[model samples]
Target: MAAMLFGGLLASNPAEAATAVSSVTVTSVNSGDITASVEGKSELAEFGEAVRDEAPELAARSVSDLAVDYRVLKVDMKQVRAQFAPGVACVDGDGNSRAEDVIVAPRNAENIRYELSGDAQRDPNYDPAKQGNRCDPDLFWDEGASPEVDDDPAASAPVRPYTEKYASACFARKSQWKDIYGIYLEVSYNDSCWSDYVTKYDGNSSWNYYSVKAPSSCHIARGTYLTSCGHGVERNAAKGPVVKWDDWAPAADSNGDCRDKGISVSVGPLSVGGSYTHCEKQNIYKYAEDGKMSSYWKGKVTGTRATQHQVSVRVAQNAGRPRWTHWINSDACVCYK
Candidate 1:
């Protein structure tokens, strides 16, 4: 079993209502594992079912030796105000009081999961036993309680301040395997990344934005070695030029033949590109069977002209029984107006 925590906060205005707050907790369980208590009201219990129906492809991709489950809970507004901003009354722009409700769903879980699994399957070094599960929880708020302003100065203003909300999550499995001169070896691990709700207020109108970014796994196969080469994305930005990446080398023994190790990245409308470094075959006489190597790359998307952009990272491996080279990729997307 594994656990992860994600949180965020938004400032409240004295003249307006405070936004409603919500949270989600994701847990991964193996067959017949001890189940955690499901907290909060069960009114939104159907959320999990909705996810399965709405994102069947994602559900399929998340499958592994273990199954994934999530629970969505409504947050207490009083607690939110006390913790983030005390003494602020909650109200809406229309001068009428408001309350928070779970108004939106998570974004991009299907596309991200599909790409991660599909890309790995397409890799020449892919290993079925190394695959793992992914779990993403979705929670966000739209309207919330606001203080009433009798003589509000902004009431006569042409446009009112409005806030737009967005949230997303993605998880990937990290696996490793080796065949040291006929001695097969294998191991599995899980990794995850997530973004809580992102709120943007521009004195306009409110709308829902669903953008999610997540990491994926990579593998290496060659000579007497066939194992998962870990891959990761350091940042999942909705809009920006800075994103970081990490790619690891395949584990090999003295008799192993590994070469051509590197990482690559691609953004919307851009071709796949990265630094490819050459790794000279280790001296076959070196008896150690636990030697490993690694490589790293940083990627940047220069422009923000596109309304929606997809970011992808690929790690290349040139090792297998027949010495074949292939690339595995992790993909994510962002949408803006």
Candidate 2:
């Protein structure tokens, strides 16, 4: 069951030293009696099979709980493109284009940015002499990166940032997305997916520029097999919370046709609706054979202080990092987006 708890009311900006609290209306659209429709349940099962086809190690285990949630959203890729750093479309050395893997955050896979060490001078955990860690590939923390496991939660937490241009990204985080039926993935608390995000992504942000737009036959298979099929929609669900595995946009249809391979999809008037139905069992471990799913949504995001909650990230000291370093963030680098 998705409990209605407060999403972290963070500072207005990530790198800020002081943390403040404010009472705002952060609500979940749909509430109790959440049940996964038979169709929804079937979708989960099929996704499990697809995953098994890809990664067999995690075959179906006896599940204690499972529920698939849904969200009806109007995705504006142009808006998404505005928020993250710029990226280029290039293929890999193997002749396979999987370059988006290098991005720190899939939403904005290229041109990742964060607070420089010099900006944290006032921070109690800030240090002057530290190892030189580069952001060319892989996101590394000096110390105290994981809040739940870290010795000092105040010192740092898993940080996700939007570009300065698009500050007010996920401001009014909907505690529950009303229209959907599924369980709330406590993504921030989950250890497995969060770690997977760090390992798979954060490499190099270059991919071959080609439209693998949805193929005619959209084969719903498992595994991270993305292709240059139909024009694809790349989205990073709940970016700040965690790099959720379930939020991945399905691979382009293989048949060179936009038809889903006999799968039921929620069709909106605008034609953008699918992530709400598909769920990879691996990402969502809490499985319930029979139950309802709920949703979370926040709207009217703008690049402003009133509309945003800030999240900051720092390195864990133990991992090749001392205390501090020498670098500065541009004034433009600070914003609510």
Candidate 3:
């Protein structure tokens, strides 16, 4: 369930994380997708939650497991010995902190079960087993449970799970206020299929990063990761770094497409301390669905890469609720090819 592609960072509500810049060298042009370290960047900003048994039952597996809205069930791996107890640094961002995870994807991988007649959304009396079923499809992860998913689900068999939609961490701006509530050290990835950790910027704002220095020298050129089509930049969740590129692994592309593909985010004439001479302008982010004000958390989930939750039996299970809700304004950077 892990092809490759990565991300990190979480701050606010006493939240914090991000480490590797000590000499900096997070290289992975395509180590078949990706793999960087610092304990894989704090295991990708680890965070957890799931002990809501008022019917939100979640007991066995290990890392994670829970389901109650695939229209109504399919994630109930009843092992009930004892579970749900992982709240590490919870995706804070203060003053309105945000953190909620429940990536229990396993049976058919996830997002199947639509035929409801109203539009054929699955549920045409969808009976993979019962109504309260999130996944127990009849367990068979490669043998014990982990081939990525599907031992049954009517044997629809097919799961390659991987979701980490945009937000490549490395925000800098918070300058003294006690490091803006300093707590830095989150590098997440508990299988990540349901992620949304925002710290905005923990390095203290006013940045102008530029990387790859020479090898093709970043900016969607050289070997080519993108430099045309929409070009890049659709990240205005709060005015900064939108969908730069993450169709999944080599751009991974498992489906959780960053905003509207054709990603961007290099905007610069950017001068603060001074530098960034010019970077033309790549765009995206003018959203105004106006549903009467919003916090839509930015939208756009293309096709093919957002399917996860197949390695359970707990250890901090978040198999794949791969979410990454971020925000930034001015002075943001991400370039690695």
RMSD of each: 25.8, 23.7, 25.6
For candidate 2, write residues 1-337 as lDDT tens digits.
3221111111223322122111111112211221245543443343334334222432352221223222112222122221221221111122221111111011212222222222123323322221111111111111112222222223244433211111100000111111123322111000001111111111122210001011111121111221111111112222222111121123221112122222111111111121222221101111121111111111111111100001112222223211111111110011133
TM-scores, each model vs. reference: 0.23, 0.20, 0.15
**Model 2 bad stretches (over 4 Å):** 1-35, 53-58, 62-64, 68-147, 151-337
Each prediction's whole-model lDDT (CA): 0.23, 0.18, 0.18
Count clashes in each candidate, considering only residues at least 3 apart in sequence or on different chains.
16, 58, 73
Judged by lDDT, which candidate is best? 1
Ranking of all candidate structures by their lDDT, best first? 1, 2, 3
lDDT of 3 by residue, 1-337 (tens): 2121111122222211122111111112201110133322221222112212111222232222222211111121111100111111222233111111112222322212111111111223323222112111111110011123211122155443222112111111110011124432211111111112111111212321211100001111112122111101112223222222212111112223233222122212211111111122222222232100101111111111111111001011112212122221111011143
lDDT of 2: 0.18
Q: What is the number of residue pairs that collide in model 1?
A: 16
lDDT of 3 at 148: 30
**Model 3 residue 2 lDDT?**
19
What is the model-wide C-alpha lDDT for candidate 3? 0.18
Candidate 3 is scored at a TM of 0.15
Task: Count backbone overlaps in model 3.
Answer: 73
